[model samples]
Target: MSQEPGWLRPHGEPWKRVSERLVYDNPWITVTEHQAVAPTGKSAIYGVVSFKNLAMAVLPLFDDGSTVLVGQHRFAHRDYSWEIPEGGGPRDVDPLESAKRELREEAGLEAAQWLPVMKVQLSNAITDEIAIGYIATGLSPVPTDPDETEELALVRVPFREALEAALAGQLPDVMTVAMLLRAYHMARERALPDALSRAMLG
Candidate 1:
């Protein structure tokens, strides 16, 4: 009989294991394993899942002060999602480039100016997906080139209303909300009193 693949072999419970990762080796992130004791004092192996991700989302702010959003389906959540132009790609791609691509693909809009607003982690307590948020300003409409599988609608909402939706828990995708919040604050940072100078500077 042939031996099973090293990664297919069991390391712990049926669902958890120190399996070979399915992503590239990026220096910013990697996995590690260690032994641990449960609260019940039972011994088990812990597999730390890690990888640096390039998650870019854009808030396309028109000169009119209305922001553009893209509505797409999220099969993982079994719901249609309305979000900023966003994507998850290999860490190899320039994050700003990813933002530009996503903006054009999803909303058919491009900005004359791009601001890198936030570099945040999805959930540092668990995964290692780093999200890069951007504020896209001075917009111009263009022909959309969405992925073949995409069926999306471009929406324009006022900046204040977008902020309200994000804060009122109406935006279901936490990641989108988080990034939009950052992008919004960053877009308005110049007008504010420069309270978060470091964040605004970056």
Candidate 2:
């Protein structure tokens, strides 16, 4: 790696964890309270929300610049959100498998090709949750088997429309916004298959 003039550097001492105790535990998440020292040497009380599974998402793309989106009422935000297929998989499981399952269950679609698009730390300040996203092509319809907890609404729309919605903040989920922007970048840079890129750009 070259040390370019415009590059940034990281130089900092790590935070010191003095003590931690579990305050709440659930199958999906655990909350732990910690007595910690910040990197600046300040004492602080921190509560961390840890996830038990890896987050996964997929953008199911068709050859003609069309995509499948799923809508559901989010409990945390208490609002309806339109997003790509997303779910959680066991940390030990492959993320691609989870992406495929989410596409099937949320959008009733399956893909013959899958490419990793992005990896994100959802909230660096609060949670230890990471999300992985993928772009899936060569799509086919299937029966949806959504999780019992989900009451999903499905829609198919042009890729450009979805991206525009994300850009306008209509789709505010961090994972969805990242995936859409990444997909746009890939299409412009020809990172995807040629025909797919052309179709997506159109």
Candidate 3:
């Protein structure tokens, strides 16, 4: 490929991998060290964290312009956080199926309609973690089936309130923030159904 004189496109030599070995391993993730060559042709060492499962998030929308959110304590941050229902799906399994289960478990609701909204790369610098988000509608109640270790608190709030909270950093989860933004965009642009968009935009 030829490069233009003014601006550079993403066409360039990429990093070359000489070798890699697993340094840390767990049921959910693996950390590996690699002997690599940079695009500049220099020897370098790189470490990467690989997830065994795909990340899945579900945002349940109610008819009255409200959505359900879940609050829980996060392990890595060692703090309490509010987020949309989310979990990991086995790599070989369908992500939508995983989203359904997560919504039911965390929020005690099942959605009759689901829309794949976003696919995001989480911290691409060191972790190969990809997240898939969905907008779930037509919610109905079910028994909460949270993980035994999780003490989840569910809240039903207006979608506008949730978006404002995320903008204010009250909801800091990347998946939550991204999905809410996407939902707002879809609602404003009328990408979703008329009734759904009206409810969300209200």
Candidate 4:
């Protein structure tokens, strides 16, 4: 019998928690401070931010190669930001439903097709915030009811133009930038429908 390789051996050691305590919390997020043993045997204190909901974003692509973008003043950055429709969905709720609602609220559009494209960690170093991206097509106009706290501007532009802006740092929202690049990649690689890809690339 051949001996098992060292690489094949189980390496299931996780960060051993020594102690943990709640530092702060709100309806949206919770901060926890933990004393833990690292995999390499070092002991340290870590602060983690836990999100109460999952972030969801939608890229609403039209048949004419245009997409919808929403502009708003972001309180955290203290500046105006242009981004694809996005919102928070409760962990217990379906992300697709949240995406749909965001689209309707932000862009006044409804999509007949939805393709989940990516899942990402927004900030691994300090926050446990997960975001999901979707490509939405077969769109139609719908009534919009934006949240009372939001004062938004909507822009419809060619997909290529939006992508160029995102690449050039005009669109700083992480989800929008990532999803635009992913959509461009899909178009170049023919990962989407033939007509849609052709329209987007052009």
Best by lDDT: 4
Q: What tens digits encode model 4's per-residue C-alpha lDDT throughout 134-169?
A: 999999999988999999999999999999999899
The per-prediction tally of clashing pairs is 0, 0, 0, 0
Per-residue CA lDDT of model 1 for 1-202, tens digit only, reads 9988889765553333323434434655666664656545566666555766687777776655667778887887888877878876677787788888888878888888887767787766557677787777768888999899888887788766776787887777766687666755554666422443233333
CA shift of 74, model 2, Å: 0.7
List, residue by residue over 13-53, the lDDT tens digit for candidate 3.
Answer: 89999999999999999999999999899999999999999
* Better-scoring candidate (TM-score), 1 or 2: 2
Is candidate 1 or 4 superior in lDDT? 4
lDDT against true structure, model 2:
0.90
For candidate 2, write residues 1-202 as lDDT tens digits.
9676754655688888999999999899999999999989999999999999999989888999888888999998889999889999999999888888888888898899999978889897989999999999989989999999999998889899999999899999888888888999999999998998888888
Candidate number with greatest TM-score: 2
Comparing 2 and 4 on TM-score, the stronger one: 2
**Residue ranges of candidate 1 with Cα displaced over 4 Å:** 1-44, 47-53, 187-202
TM-score of each: 0.70, 0.95, 0.94, 0.91
C-alpha positional error of residue 174 in candidate 2 after TM-score superposition, expressed in Å = 1.1
